[model samples]
Each structure stands twice: as C-alpha cells, then as structure tokens.
Target: MEGNLAAVLADRADTYGWRDRPLFHSGAATYSHGEVHDAGARAAGVLRSVGVRPGHRVLIALPDSIAFVAALLGTLRLGAVAVLTGPELSGREHAYVLGDADPRAVVCGPGLVPRFTSVPVLTGDDLADEPASLPDPVPVPAGAAAYVQYTSGTTGDPKGAVHRHTDPAAYHEAMALGALGMVPGDVSFSLSKACYPYGLGATVFFPMFCGGASVLWPDAPTVRGAVEQARRHRPTLLFTVPTWYARLVSGPEPRAVREAFASLRAAASAGEPLLPSLGDRIEEVLGCPVLDGLGSTEVGHTFVSNTVTRRRRGALGVVLDPYEIAVRGEGGVGYEGRPGEDRAAAAAANAAGLGAGGQAAARIGERGALYVRGPSVMIEYLGKPGRTADALGPDGWLRTGDLVHVDEDGFVHHHGRILDQVTVSGERVLPLEVERILGQHPGVVEVAVIADADADGAGEEAGGGALAAFVVADEVAPPVPVLAEELIGLARERLPEHKVPRSVTFMAELPRTSTGKVRRSALGRAELSRNGDGSLR
Candidate 1:
C-alpha cells in the first residue's frame, strides 16, 4: 500500500483498525498492533537519537520477544538495514558478526555491553522508554536493503543474505496468504526463535501481514514449553523443524496432550526433511498433519512448501508459483565456485535448454541439484560478494545444494545434499533416504546416518565399512542390541543392503548447530573416541 515495508505494513494495519487488534500474544501480555508500531516508532527515534542514520546497519541480537520485533520494525522504519543474530550466539560469534556487519549501533542484552564499549548498545528498556512522539517512517526504495540474516553455517562460515524492503511483503503474499492461506483470524507459533530466518517469516511476516497474532516467548522452547505454548496460545498454525516434532511425540503419544494443539489445523516443518514415520506420529498425537518443505537463508523463506490444502504424504510439495525451479544435471549450466565463475553453474545445473518459465527439469525420478530463482530470493550476500557469486548466479538463481528428485506426481523428494553423498560397501547411499526409513523405528527419537569422511569416494567404502547411525533413543528404549536390530531391520525392509547401517551408536543427543540442524561433520570425530565395542568411549 505504501513504499517502505514498515510504513506500508503500518498503513495497512491502521487503515483497517487492525492497529487496535492484538498482534503478539506473549504469555499473559498482549501487544496490540498500534502498541508494537508505537514501540517501533519510539525505537526508531531512539536509534536516530543515538546518531544512527538511514542505510546504516543495526545489529539486533535478541530473543523471540516483543523487543526484538520492535527493534527490527524500528530499524526498517528508520530506513536502516537490520542484522539479525541469535541471542545465544557466543561472544566470539558476536564479535565476528559485529566486525563483519560493522553496524552503526546494537540492540542486545546486558551481557554484550562490556564488549561494545566503543559503540552504542541499546537494551529493550531503552526502546520502551523513548520520547512520547516520533517522526513518520523514512522513505526508501522497495529494493533497498532492509535486513541481513546470516546463514546457519551448515554449508560454511555464516554469510549474511541481504533482503529488500519489498521482500517481507512479497514473502507474506506468496507464502503466508498464497501458500498457507492464512487469514486475519489465524494465530501462529514457531519453535524457531525470531533471530532465525525461517522463524522471522513465521512469527513476524506471516502473522503481522495477515493481521494474525504470533505467540512469543523469550527463550527457545523445550518440549514441555512447546506443548505449554500450544495449550495456552491455541495457535491456529505451527512452524518448526522435524527435530521438535519427533521430541514432542517421543516416549509416548499423549492423546490428551494432543488436545493442547487441537486448535492447530497444521504444523509446517522446514530446515530438514521430515521423516514419514515421525510425520505420522505428529499427525496422530499432535492432531495435525506435519507439512514438509525446504528453504535456506538466501531464499528468505520456504519457496517450495506443502500447505494443508495441497500436500502429499512424504514429499516437499510443489514449488510456489511465484518462483521457478530448474534442476542442474549432466549438461546444464551451473556455478564453478570460482570468483568470477560463480555466475552460473552451481545453481542452474548441468542441463540443456530452459523449459517454460525458467525451469530445467531432471528426469522424472532421477536425482539433480536444485536451483531456484524468484522475487523473494535475496539480492546479495552482504559484504561477501565472492561467496555470493559462488552461491547465486547472474541470472538470480540460487544454488540450493539440495539434491532432489521429482516424482511423476510433481512432488519433490529430498535425496540428501549434493555434497553430503557418500559411498558405503561400493554403493552410493543417500543418508537422508535411509535415515527416514530407520527413523520410523519406535525406539528412535532422533537419528543421523553418516559415512566416514576419510573414505575415498572412488573405491574404498566409508569408514572401511558400511553406513553408521547415530541415534538418540527414547528414555524407555531397549538395549543397544535390540534397538540396533530394530533400526537396521527397519531400514533393511525399506532400503537396499548397502544403505543399511553396519554400525549403530547410542547417543544421549545428536550434536547440533544452534539453529538445530545435525552437525554431520562433527560425527566424523566420534569414530576416533570409540571403544573396542564401537560405542563412544
């Protein structure tokens, strides 16, 4: 409706009297749309009072609370780029990000105050205690950088993806309204903290744009906390990763507990492929179908997703119509990972001519790396043009690094990462494919299948053996022997012999990155500390 994102969103809400409606439901406190924008406007005034200016970056490292949202909205309102980071990020990480972004000011907790002695570090209280009145939103082009969200560092060191003032609105229209069919009556909750890119779209963009309310908590939720929030907030929709879903229904399926989420029509899962068995558990116990999708920081939000209305049982669902996809196979264009060569190959893939609407399909069921180009994708990676070139092409295509196969029904099936492929017993095995089958075992709460990183891809099998599975079993799980048999036996029933794990390790928990993806590379070191019986020493 208007130009700047904050201005436009504020205009829409005010025009509809939505400003008086509840926008954030946090514990017993509710912040109305007008209250949040008022706080945001005051926050902008405070940032401006402290000498912050348009086009400058404001690093915001806070929890999933009203203050974080206020800081983000205020920064955008002032025509500045906001750099988002997890509040729990280590001092070293914070230092690295501060150096990389070189922000004009910071909005963080008190603990970070010592390190930012030279720069202004505004706490939540500062934003809440600003002057009574403030100026209108600063004018900026829709394409101007509005924010920077760093990657989870799974692929490499974190790189900031710069999104535009128009992007969040685009995401809201394409994903929230178009894909999820969210309405003003909907209320949402997410396991991802707002600092995360996926969580940003879920809790911030979706709810705000749709005139729906988001349930906010200061910290990341535990399994109990997740259920509690669901029970209390009664959100109509939920967004999270597969890990939380498995944990929620683990140990036992609580039918009464499922009532906590009875209001939810569906829960969306991204960040990883959702295991079919876990998905079933979610459906049965949570009383909602777990919708699976795939996305990255560069893509801004889930570009390929499954909605409650249109979804398959075990697929990533169809690509959203606003975006176009191409699979890079043997003969297509792709990025070469070099400085200048980063223009094309890694994303567009090794395929022939482009199909209708920028698509280059893989064979009906063959594996190929995915490439996506859309209006919602990032304009560039902030301050990392070389790495950006490697990941994004001149054509606007982003190299997803995700290997997927399109089914005859047009659903996309995840086949692990293009770089994550490993050979076991002379056969190439997709860990995710096998992990999904093994994950179906009742005793398994979580699982990660990996081959030895040291193994030669050409001839020698990984670990000089077949595959291995690192499992976090339920508390009531059987001994390693029985659990191993059940998991391996389950995989054997659905997968080839080579794909079955030759060794099984019982772990209290899988090592994970802050954003919750399994740290697959860290598992490689577990082999070094193993005892004679093959368990971790």
Candidate 2:
C-alpha cells in the first residue's frame, strides 16, 4: 500500500477483503481479482520479453476489454510507463504519440499492428493466451511516472500529460470517498474507456479501492447499450459524462432501466460540465443524485468535486480537500477581480481565496488565469520539457488556462477558455457565458457561441467581429427572433451589451470532441456555412 501504484493495486487485491470477487465484467468474459492479477503478470512477462524494461514507455492502444485492463496493469507492474492512447484516435495521431514517447514496445490489438511495424508489438489477446502467474512487482518510487495521456492542444497537436504511480491511488482514495461513498458489495460501471485517466480512476481503481465489482466492455456507442449492461448486471453505481446521460434520457422510455437502477447508490459525471436541466432530468428519471466532478488529464482525477450530499444544479460544486485550488494574475493572487475586468476576471482577479482546507484559488487581477497547487497535479508533460516548464511554474503551481471566478460562497464558476475570449465592440466577451445563458432556455438542448464578423452593424462592424451563437433545440427550431431577443436580454441583464451574441443559428447538433468538449472553432465555421458567405469560410 505504500510503494508504487502497481504495488498498491496488488496490495488492495490481497488485503482489501474483496480479492475473491469479480473485478471486471466484459460480455462473456469475467475476470476476478486472482484472474486479473495473473493476467497482469502474463502481460508483464510478454512486455519484458519484448525488451520493455523498467521506466521504458510502452504504447497501449487497444479496445476496452479485459485485455486493456490487463495490459495497463501489466505495464505498471513492470515499472514501465504506459502510454495510453485511445483506439479511436487516427493512425497518424497514434504515430505522433508513439513517436513522441518513443515507446520500447507496443501492446495493442491486431488492428493497430500495421501502423507501427518497426516496433515490437505484442497483442493483448496473445498475452491472454500465455500462462498466468504472479510476476515480481517492479520496484519504483512513488513519484515515478505511471502513464501518459495525450490531450489535444490549441496548436493542432496533442500534448501528453504524464502521471505518477501514486496519482491514481490518491484519486481512488479521495474522490471515491466523497463521490461514491462506496461500500463492500457495490457494483460499479463506467462508460469511459479504460485508457482515459478518469475512466481508469472511476471504473477500475475506485471499485478496487472500495472492494466492489467493476463492469468493463469493449464498447458502448449508444446509451441503450450502457443501460442494458446496467440492467443486466444490476450495477450499484454508474460513472459517465453529461452527453451520455443526455442521450440516455432522450432515448427510449427509461422506466425499466430506472427501476433496475434502484440498487444504484451513486452516479457521477465528469469530462464536461453537466447542464442543470440534464441533471434534473436524470434525477427525476432515476431518482438518484447525479453528481458532477471537474478534472483534467494533468490533474489525473477529480480534485474538485460536487458531493452527492451537496448537489448544486448549475454550479461545478466545491473543491475536494485532497488538493489546493487557486487563481493568479501577473500582479498578485486573490479572489474577486478588480473593477472593469470581465465578470470572470473581476471575480477571480487578484484574490487568493482559500478553501476550507487552506487550498488557495489564486486569482490574477483583471485578466487573471486559473492556477492550481495540489498533489494531484501532473509531474510534467511527457517529452515536452519547454511546454512542461511553461505550464508548471518554478513554484510548483500549475497554470490552468481556464478563466474562472469564485463567488462569495466559495463556488468556482468557469467563464470560458482563456484562448476563447473575444473582444467585441471594445468590450470583452466570453462565449461560454453567453452559451450558458442561451442553454438555460427550455427549447435549447445545447448551444455554442462564437465570434464572427458583424455583417449588419455599420460602424463597429467595419472589419470587426461580433458574437454569433449556434443552438440545437429539442421541440421546434428555436424561434430565431425569440432566441435573439432572449439572448440579448439575458446578456444585457447578466453581462455587458457588447458581450451579447448578435446572430443566432439553429443546428441539429453542435460539434463536439470524443470527450464531449464543444469545438468552438468548428462551430464558427458552421456559422459561416449557414450564412452562405464565402468570406468567412
């Protein structure tokens, strides 16, 4: 329990009191603690045979199956860094990650063999076929690198966030205590791929830490698939994102599914912000609190979480005690920004608002960025020394590019991406704020706000950009006139007039990443396409 993460996982398996119970469930393929531990040993043997030594990075690009879990555990068990790339990523992207990491070997599925023919490849299926035995757990420091998670960068490249072996265990111990309150005999299911740090924490580590059962699958494209698995397994808990929840609530009558989930004690959401309406709908349907937590790959897991006992519909809940949260500006650290700065800027500006546990939310005055100083923070960005130094300062504080503010009640509100802020008519406009307000409308299911040239405005519109919004509505096309009126009205009331969106376009669905974050640049191009204008296109 005190050594490396692989040791911790093995320790939990032996002493957590549920070692004999089912640890994973893939359709027609169930693996218990002993089976999984043996599979990890076999995977380690294969990796070692391929010249993967301690501290060497090994790329793992396989589907979510028992093999995926085994490979991850095996890599860690060998003290090899697991470069976890998603199976959904393009071959080029996979190559980028593999090349960056320069992995000693790759343990992937048969489908990925062609991409990296030069490197030694060991299929997860092949590893499963090998004899299972208890391999010696690799000796490593608690701070040794565990895995790499590549996040899409603003420059159209992917940046790898590296975590230490101790990170995931910290996540399972802290976040699970507050979010799941899980007990022995609990059954948990996660829709996120095991390769994802969040999924690894919520789906695998949490259950193991709590002495519960975890259900894994190869894939679940449709929410119905998730519901069917939940119904069949009668899992006591489910962890997923808001987009998946939205799809589920919007799908077929969920009465039976809801009733089947009667045994479920807690459900959690992450990856993206959960709309209050979506949370309400799920709560009404399943009669359970849909908890939400905000985390990033750099942080590894949920450090700031909204607990089930204190659920706030729209707010991103309070910060968990395991880490310290703060915001900072070039000038100083504080909470509540100076006057004339945007709402986010003013709220988070120049103030060092400390949480109950002495963790500070440092606010950069008037144009401040969010900063975090916590044990959960990543050690470094893999293979990118310059980027790592830029993000993690000499003081050990991590710069989070999200612009945010803390209210008097100590709730942090996300304003927008630091790069997404636009200046419209000489005033700062945050697309996320406008989009949040627009999303509150009953007719609107989702919305994305962007900046475009103001074709109609005369003087200020000359070569200048204005705000535009794209919406996906449920009932009828959101009355453009009413949408325009309400959006402008809401902006004027809650924000400056210049921050209001001038144009609105209704679409079937907004563009989103696989993880559910809206692609604002894509939405901007879509707006140009809708206008039938070649200029912006």
In TM-score terms, which candidate is top?
A: 1
Candidate number with greatest lDDT: 1
Model 1 over residues 1-537: C-alpha lDDT tens digits?
337888888888988879989999999999998888888888988888887889999999888888899899899999999999988888888888899899999998877777666578898778877664685898997578999998878777888899998877766765687568898889989888888878899898887888889999886678778778888888998888888877777745477568788998878888888888788878988777778988788878887777767889788887775776666676452212211232244334424444434455344456677888877799888888898899898888898999886655556778888777777766667788878787777777788988854334433433345677888887777877777777777888888777877778777678887777888888878354654444566
lDDT value, residue 9 of candidate 2: 73
Question: How would you encode candidate 2's per-residue C-alpha lDDT over 1-537 as one tens digit per residue?
Answer: 456676677677898655687888777667787777777888887777778789899898988877887888888988889998888888878878877889998888788899888799888887776643446888897588888987755435778889888777667755787656777677887777778776878677887677777888777456668777877787887788776776666545768668767777778888777777777778877778888777787888876667767666676666665666665554445553211236543444334454323445444323356677666689888778999998898876777787765555555566667888776776667777777777677666666777765444423335256787777665543456676566567666876667676766766566766566777777655345654321122
**TM-score (all chains, Cα) for each model:** 0.91, 0.87
Off by over 4 Å in 1: 333-362, 425-427, 453-465, 531-537
- lDDT scores for all predictions? 0.79, 0.72
Error of 1 at 476 (Å): 3.9
